[model samples]
Target chain A: MDSLAEELIQIKREGAAAVLATVTGADENGGVEPGQKCLVRDGKIRAGSIRDWALLQAILKEAEARLKEERSKLVPFDIPGTQGKAEVFFEVLPSPPKLIVVGAGHIAVPLVKMAKILDYHVTVLDDRLQFANRERFPDADEILVGDMAETLKGISITPWTYIVLITRGHKYDEPCLREIIHGPAKYIGMIGSRRRIKACFQRFRDEEKIAEEVIQRVHAPIGLDIRTETPEEIALSILAETIKVRRGGAAQSLSGKQ
Target chain B: MDTIYDQVKEFLDKGETVAVATIVSTKGSTPREVGAKMVVTAWGEILGTIGGGCGEADVRREAIEVIRTRKPRTVRVDLLDDISSDSPAVCGGIMNVFIDPWWKEKEG
Candidate 1:
């Protein structure tokens, strides 16, 4: 294999995020010609070609825009004193965001696995040591055993974090939800039946005095309504919903209705 | 078949130029949905399948071309084309494939 292809494979193995720039035209100096590729990571030029300093500078500006947009496309530019259109391919490879599944119940198992398969960094948290073992969640990046709320105390939830509550029961779900609801997680969900959801909302409304709007943020009865019955199927449904919410997609199902 | 990561790593370790074809989007009844990946090496060896059959063949050809030219591209393959006469597969679907080639950089 060529060094370029080899390096790309290495990047994929290490799960590195990078930007690839390809030149499509060049000036009289033969710099920044068509079909040249460059690899950029962490704001630094790693490899590939755009030989001319001016052309590289121009490509960098366009590369930054492609990275911000997280898009891979041919961008056209005109080199100084050059007549031809300099079209270069700018491809951004952003690391997959982390998805923290706060409960390691039956639902959490599939969710963690599915998230990993989808290239998300997955962490499975549970107070039960047996349930939160590596054997069960081989794909998880981390498995934490402790009080859900307390364990998450020091961990700041970012805009990229995905928090799901599939704890053993409502006892664990409510406290965890109460704590994380105000955090910056991009997606939050709790698995429960209709009655359980109603009861949890009542407690949140009456005892905790949590506003209805805040409670509404929780995706109770989590997962799309595919009438999913099995743990695996339910996990898929929840994942679909979480992706929809994260991608700013409408919450309504493809079958229509919320 | 080897896992996506394993196959990709193997190709890279061998120092072969490779093109990664990811099924970024799909419509109708394509065999594989989004996120499915296929890797094609410079020598025409394939490590995975975006769907299989002619659809995969077309992607393989395109990936080889990308590797030769060191260009990253997205190609739309129609699976519903007539297999017998004009086109490749008749799967009755379409897929948008992103073909990205890997490269090395000199660190200063």
Candidate 2:
């Protein structure tokens, strides 16, 4: 790969934020043509072809704003003495994280609210109109009332999409789980009892011929074992597990004594 | 990985110059969000999409110029230009697309 493409890959692998600034509009007098670009990571020019010292410095200063908002923008900059203006497009390279809540029950209500606070693009889905309406999920980015299993098949599942199956029982969860078991989701957690999950896995293995390793991806008996007692606490635990997966954190108490 | 970077890397390896067009900003409403990208080859072939329609077609024309000149440019697509048409690109918003060229490094 070329250096710029290689740098792009490394940034995504590390899950680090970087900015790609491309000069999109420039007067002929400015000399810098549109499309001349640079990549800034950690406040340094990691890879780029823009050689203007002043323009590079301007990009370094503006990159922090793009990263803070986590949004792409067209920013205009004027060199110290240049007469014309140059508009540069800053493309934030971090893919926005998304959450797909499979059931719009009690746990999902708080879960959707909390996920939105964490800046996740949250979607709530269920098979019943009474349960999956806007009144209950005012903060949800999207809500769908349809066949839970079939709706999942149509939705695009990306590596950044986190799926949580908290249906009333395993019968509902099982159908949804089968649709996305081997798909490319960052996290797939289903709520169930330990014994019930074991039986479900056995059936999946014997009858459906799914690989054990693939079945292992599902976080059955989902959530961090924080001794959750209420639906609110359970929702917090589920969100915590997804955070740990995305940030690569060990679920350890941050104290001197264990 | 389904990133556009991987596709760009493949084309660069083949010694082909390509233009990567990205929607940097939008006002009012837009078909695609910011950072949506589409890759245009020298032959005007498109790999991804930035909300296809007359707007995308306009970007394609500029992308060819970007590939030929090896110069980056920003094209402002006015979705309001043709509101009477049934094209889905009529979002009644304006968007700015930055088209940049990509090629293998010159052996230094």
The TM-score of the first chain in every model comes to 0.68, 0.67
On a 0 to 1 DockQ scale, where is model 2? 0.25
lDDT of each: 0.72, 0.85
Using TM-score as the measure, which candidate wins?
1
The residue pairs in collision within model 1 are A1-B14, A1-B15, A1-B16, A2-B15, A2-B16, A2-B17, A4-B102, A24-A34, A46-B105, A47-B105
**Tens-digit per-residue lDDT, A179-221, candidate 1:** 8888877778887778888898898899988887787777877
Scored by lDDT, model 1 comes in at 0.72
Q: lDDT of model 2 at residue A117?
A: 94
DockQ of each: 0.18, 0.25
Candidate 2 per-residue C-alpha lDDT over A67-175 given as tens digits, one digit per residue, 9 for 90 to 100: 7656678888886467867888898886568899999999999999999999888889999899999999999999999999999999988767899999988899999
Position A58, candidate 2: lDDT: 85
Count: clashes, candidate 2: 2
Stretches of model 1 off by over 4 angstroms after superposition? A1-10, A24-31, A51-84, A92-94, A113-121, A134-141, A154-160, A168-171, A178-184, A192-221, A229-233, A246-258, B1-43, B49-88, B91-108
Query: Across residues B3-104, which tens digit of lDDT does each residue of candidate 2 receive?
Result: 788888889889999999999888878899988999999999999999999899999999999999987777899998777878777988899888888888
